[model samples]
Target: MPSFSHDPLSPKDAADVVIVGVAARGLAAAARRAGLRALVLDLFGDDDTRELALAAIPLRRIGAFAIDPADLYEQLAIHAGPDIPVVLGTGFEHQPEVVERLAARFRLVGNGPPTLAWTKEPLMLARLLHNLGIPHPQVFADHAPAGMRTLEKRIGGSGGWHVKPASESRGWGWYLQEELQGRTVSALFLGNGHKARLLAFSEQWCEPSEDAPYRYGGAAGPIRLDPSIEASIASALDAVVNAAGIVGLASADLMLTGDGWSLIEINPRPGASLDVFDHEPLPPLLRLHFEACRGELPDLALLTPEAAGMVRGAGVFYAPFSFEMRLDPLPDWVADRPPQGTRIETGEPICTLFAAGRDVREVRDTLARRRDQLWRDLSMASRKAAE
Candidate 1:
């Protein structure tokens, strides 16, 4: 039987929480900040993750993009003690069945399989948005709409990497949607199945490469929004929470276009923006998630001026070429650090760089400078080795 322990500070001998994801560093960090002992399972058991987690295990990768579900289940079953509640992150978004299977075996926190299926289904979400009178991009399942610029996206795909031009033919599990050009914004919220409270609003950016055009680059904010715009988004979210029965931490991706704000998709989990929105004085997000899941909503008054005004940004620094990762005593600014002597292929993400400041522009600038400097340092090291 699954176990539920309200005490986050359980003995270090056993895990109080187990976090599973494609990259679980952020979630593990949040759990640690909340005074919980977390066991992390992900594809990259990065250096920071190991430091934060009681135990860290790498999930098996299938090809360059997919996680092997069987491997994930086997690892979880081996490490997750009976009754230990599991918190899922990025990897299982594409495999709801796997999540369902895991939930059947272990105590799964956050949203259940039904909630995930309801929110992740493109057609269902589009219809819900339409019925709510919210602006949303038109989605077509299994076929492209005639004579309109559309993008092909995979079901259960997160991080925007799975999106491509509709002109290209792909295998099954693909759907087409009208492309919108505008500012990409994400709203992070805490919900209790009936209502949701906004935690932060962030501007999302993508880094397009030859292979992954819509690759998630980074995010910046807790940005101030026009009162009217914020109201509209809040109203949309309220409708969504009631409609989908979303509980705990969730994010809504939308585009502010010439027409208006159009809903993109909903991430029913602790998303990438957790790092940008996480601040002190307020309880850690993972704690808030746990509280909200138990039907308690966090107090919005806890959002202090410092927490709301402070802007944080993170950018993924991709390897410019195939090189071995070698940063001894890794810089404090860099995270998701691969083990030394690990061979990284060209275009693969190297590490994530983070910066925080009072001004969003300054934070973004600092992140950019840091990213460039790290790449230059890597290039110089490579050249020296060759010489």
Candidate 2:
């Protein structure tokens, strides 16, 4: 078992940093690349994450979908001390106060609470982008905007699981958005609270669940782009980062249409796509993130194209039905694996699949093949378990 408690302030016994998030594997992996030991407050306690972490506490034990801030505070008390750096990942957007509390106790190396507050608020973001003459989908806060292709989205939602048809149902903190037609594209960048640097652009896709159609499936990148489109995106990111005073790792989601890219939202903390872009020979992003937070920008070398004709992709595989995990030995290509014999509900993510190829189509085909192979392997394992 990974250590849950380390001797406070003892470098020999303590982890170098504390990582808290629903998707902590990428952060943990990045930390290890920087030669740092990570104590990860993770939701899944995935098998691969445990291998990379000094400690991987299953935040799922506290709650499946959302985290309780009090539980996180208590867990930190057990595993970390004030000197340790804390980097938050996805899942803290709606709880800025909790981030504020963490900042008061530890050295936070990413954007602080105030950044999340401004960036995640739908109306505020729409207005900011509008003021900057950026294209943004119309946001309706109080009542639904009649006669527009609309979506009902949960406030501060990251993955699209919280989005649904505007006509189906509505609840508190839910706002209506005009659904624009386009390909989903994202810019993974680092900011120094004033100037910004573009890391890479990736294409994002949705893997529809039984309930959620826009649920995030995967992303692939180092995608080369037309110079004009790239310049427009770079300019937009610089403006938003400066206006929001965003620092450290951040991402801007956009809709690339027949006309141009429209701003969707800016994720202020470390994003899920770190796994897509972080690789060998490139300086580990976590190291760059720290430097950026300290007001230093990464070298332009990072913006250079990846090696000719090579691209990488990451995809999530959700369970087809509720079942007990029967694969005893997990595959190398898969990540974020739950323990064998654990029960997983229908539509819940079972693992992540990684693949590489010359272009997007090949990468997608490889991931699909891997997913099929995994399901077949599970069937054989389950039958053997019964025998």
Q: What is the C-alpha lDDT of each candidate?
A: 0.82, 0.82
Task: Give a tens-digit lDDT track for model 1, residues 49-153.
Answer: 998888788889998756798898788767886588889988777778988898899888888888887788888888888998989898887666567788889
Q: How many clashing residue pairs, candidate 2?
A: 0
Query: Which residue pairs collide, candidate 2?
Result: none
Question: What is candidate 2's CA lDDT for residue 285?
Answer: 87
The RMSD (Cα, Å) of candidate 1 is 4.1
lDDT of 2 by residue, 1-387 (tens): 454455454432468878989868889998989888888897788777888988788774345578777788888887778888888998888778888998999888898877776688888888888998888898887566556778888888878898877743375677878888989988889999987898888888899977899999999876866678888888888888888889998998889888677888889988778878888556788988999999999776334345524678899898887677899787888888788877888888888999888787888999999999998888678668778
Candidate 2 wrongly placed segments (more than 4 Å): 1-13, 60-63, 167-169, 301-309
Best by TM-score: 2
Worst lDDT run of 10 residues, candidate 2, spans 300-309
Root-mean-square deviation of Cα positions for candidate 2 versus the true structure, in angstroms: 2.4
Clashes of 1: 2
